[model samples]
Target: MRASTPAYTMSRPMSESVAAIVNDDIISTYDLAQRMRLLIATTGIQPTQENLPEFQQQALLSLIDEHLELQELKRVEKDQKFPIILNDQEVRDEITDMASNNKMTADQLLASLKSQGIAEDTLFQQIRASRSWEHWISGRYGSRLRIGEDQIQATKARLVAAASKPQYDVSEVFIDAGRAGGMDAANKGAAQLVAQLQQGAPFAAVARQFSSSSTAAAGGDAGWISPGEMPPQVDTALEQLRPGQLSQPIPVKDGVYIIYLRDKRAGAGQTLVSLKQAAIALPADAPAADVEAARTKLIAVRSQIKDCATLEATVRNTPGVIAGDLGEAETSDLLPEFAEAAKTLQPGQLSQPIRTKVGLHVLAVCGKRAAGAAQIDHDQIENRLKGQQLSMISRRALRDLHSTATIEQR
Candidate 1:
């Protein structure tokens, strides 16, 4: 029973201007402006002339949703003769936590907002609506929700099987096209978000405030996703990104996405090893005497290379010897000599000096993880399933309210 986009008209307005009407209530121009400012301030999204219109649209949409949620909750409470109390203390507590995260006191935060010309009530009302809606959702639906043992087992099995694939630690921000009014708006919004992220905006904060994905509640953390698990476009994007980089806006059927890669690793079940190499570079056809000298030089320093940390310094101190970091890699992926050496040594152990076509090399095993070692526990899987269910329920309920409500935008 979802309705189409609520009819809207474009126009300029002063502080006292009416921006939208919802049921029997109104959202004023001042409210929309302050909310937009708050979004930028809390989320660290830079405000620019090019993106101001997108910001306004996002802010207005958020306000409309909040109005719908609050109004529905009030109606349910009154009709069912139940109490749905969200007091100032609760809002204050949230503010305190938020301020503490930003390394500011509540008073200081309010003062800072005041300096920005945002009224304190604007922040409070937003928090109140969010908390109230969460309470109502949990209370109304918590008991009815269930996760079967089979479901948990299936999820665990799937995760364990997928552990053999490469995984990326990722966070995302999704802009739903339907909510944004069309594909163009959604893409523009996603591009705007990407611009802000590239300019040093905090990704987690921005995701919490703006992403429409279910993971938005967890600041868009998707946590160790493997290839083939995500959409083809997303998989392609992740493949092109290195650790600590963001993807450009990727348009999909439902919306657009911006992803941040925190880290990536080889297949979890592979024999992962961290190594450092000390080598004396030599020609393939070097004289036997020259090769012997290189071997002697490496041998002399081999005992001195007690650990990975000191390997470089030891090499630097010894003339004609060079140091290299093999970094972390799967043993099978390493060169044959390096792989064989890695397989035989434990962490902190050094291999005997070995000769190769390029040089005489000494390898130190900094660390190792045995094959088939990845794990995701039962509790974590259960919680993820429950969260997904709750998110779906919340979305469906809200969509119903939107369809049944009276709304007009100006």
Candidate 2:
């Protein structure tokens, strides 16, 4: 799992070779090269001399996991006496969707990869393994899980309590040691992922493909989390991070985590307001008489506009007047003077003329959502709960497979 491994570890260097062995299956050197190309192509990681070894190691690791998963799928089918065959069309459909997401037709996508020296069959095989595993896992386990109202209420209560505390908007990439076959492998994989991230790879794309966390489906977006919501190591990492920063791999009991701090907020329960404004253009150095005239003109226009809907029309009729629709934002995001005026106004109420360097302006409060007015998303909560459970089960399943299987890394 370390970078000490040779970049080329071919048992037979004279011909097509094997990177590793998973039970009876051989992961070919050709397979490793194709997967590395795919990883770089999809994640946009800038390949370099220093990072190429890491990429090779990670690609071989991924290929081994896929081999184990495909073997398990077959074993389960044979034991259960059910038809668990992964339909060819399913894999093709997934490829088509991938192509569409990249703004290409299926044939065009294949041609593009071909031009880049990647085989079409390599892509199909990877998709087939992934689709097979996902279908089996979701169908077998997802249908059996049930969430109760008590659980939902408990989660909602926690959210409400956390609303009073500072929250972080974060994304993550988790490498499960169990799934990776050991702590060393997980750590190395996490480091490789970070290298790609640092080199401009898209975090979401990488997370969906590599992270074993429940949030992987959401591009690792762990939104608006307060203290004590994450693991102790993760919390410590977050505490030291400013917005738009990435954390180095943090080792934990089960795996390693990489955190990306997207943003931070004082709290979640801040008041949100929607506003509209009418302004009369005037220079700051204008004479006192001119300022008064602009203020006087704005006051007259404000009287004619009973609410936000009428403000724009009133501004249109008055020359030199401009209207603006300031969309919803937290009160803290607004200017201090504007925030004060907004706090005093109710929906549909107009503010007194306020003077700024740009002009004399009157603001209308379109709407306000009081602190804690945000609704709890029941569906989102349920999905999160289910995803967490599924992620745990998946790791255990893969771990068991790893323990029983014969694996050899060249």
**Top candidate (TM-score):** 1
Pairs clashing within candidate 2: none
What C-alpha lDDT values do all the predictions have? Answer: 0.82, 0.80
Candidate 1: pairs in clash: none
Q: Candidate 2's residue-wise lDDT over 94-165, tens digit each? A: 889888987999889877877777777777777877777777888999999898877866775576556667
TM-score of each: 0.71, 0.67
Cα TM-score of candidate 1: 0.71
Candidate 1 RMSD to the correct structure: 14.4
Candidate 1 residues 1-410, lDDT tens each? 21122132123344378899999889998789889988888888778899899889989999999999988877787899766747767777888988898899988998888777777787888887877887788888877888897887677556545667778999998888878889998988888889888999999999988888889877899988777666789999998999999999999888898999999987765677889999988878989999888888888899777778888998999988899998988889988878899877766789888778888899998866545554556677788888878877887887798889999999
Query: Weakest 10 consecutive residues, lDDT, candidate 1?
Result: 1-10
* Worst ten in a row by lDDT for model 2: 1-10
lDDT of 2: 0.80
Count of residue pairs whose backbone atoms collide, per candidate:
0, 0
> In terms of TM-score, how similar is model 2 to the real structure?
0.67
